[model samples]
Target: MKDNKQSEKDSSADNVDEYLQTLGNEDARERRYYSQEQPFSADEMTRLVNEERLNALLAQSDAFLSSLNSEIKDFNDEC
Candidate 1:
């Protein structure tokens, strides 16, 4: 019974060591990838952010205009 428990403990420790090794390998791979030059420059990133903001604003404006148009049509119909 004691031997069985020891064997289980040894197996669990081995599994933990293997899992830690795998994690270390993944971290090294990620570091290598991030160390490379980025695909987008700072200026390009800024432009992309500004363009996204503009698109969001345009979508909001369109929604507001559509709602206003509907309201105006309903008022006209009631008149």
Candidate 2:
């Protein structure tokens, strides 16, 4: 019947409107867009690791050299 078809169309339109309204919800709409992080490549990562290791070794060597200098100075002063 004509009435039954109209009722089905009305219910379908209402469902679509409800779905559209839900799209405005906070959970549905994020505050900001997500970004992907850039990771270093194999060669770049290895270079960074080596650079840090060399820097640490240099610092340790400098500290050892300073300790030896102080000890020599004390011995010379005593002599």
Candidate 3:
């Protein structure tokens, strides 16, 4: 598992190692954004949003939210 993670990390680094291979373009005519073309379809987005693993993050209990809120408030007061 550690080797797999290291391999994945190395692959990501190699992907990003190119010169100006990410984000923007030098030519205004070539410059574009993801907003111009949606990568995922609406159905895909809906499925992703409704995924059990993702939804689990939003399904916090009332007690958890209360504790989190108290901690946030305490931190704010301390600051």
Candidate 4:
């Protein structure tokens, strides 16, 4: 019974090692596929990030202008 328990533990450890190795192999394959198959470029990524930043800035500017206009309107009404 003791020997059987040891064998079971060894088998479980082996299975875990095998599973980890398989996961590593799959991750490597995915990285290779993305590197080879994807059309994404560093320059394009940079451009996209810059565009997003500019868009956010423009939105903030528009909101600020609208709020300032409203405040001016309220002041003119008080006058």
lDDT of 2 by residue, 1-79 (tens): 9999999999999999888888766544553333344678999878778787789999999999999999999999999
Off by over 4 Å in 1: 38-79
Models sorted by TM-score, best on top: 4, 1, 2, 3
Q: List the residue pairs that clash in candidate 1.
A: none
Instruction: Tell me the whole-model lDDT of each prediction, alpha carbons only.
Output: 0.94, 0.84, 0.74, 0.94
Clashes of each: 0, 0, 0, 0
Candidate 1 vs. true structure, TM-score: 0.45
Which ranges in model 4 have alpha carbons more than 4 Å from their true place?
Answer: 38-79
TM-scores for the candidates: 0.45, 0.39, 0.34, 0.47
| Candidate 1 lDDT over residue span 13-37, tens digit each | 9999999999999999999988996
Identify the leading candidate in terms of TM-score.
4
Over all chains combined, what TM-score does candidate 3 have?
0.34
Q: Could you give candidate 3's per-residue lDDT for residues 2-73 as a string of tens digits?
A: 999999999888878753454334343354543377588888899778578666766666668989999999
- Tens-place lDDT digits, model 4, residues 1-79: 9999999999999999999999999999999988898665989878767787789999999999999999999999999
- Residue-pair clashes, model 4: 0
Write out the backbone clash pairs for model 2. none
What lDDT would candidate 3 get against the real structure?
A: 0.74
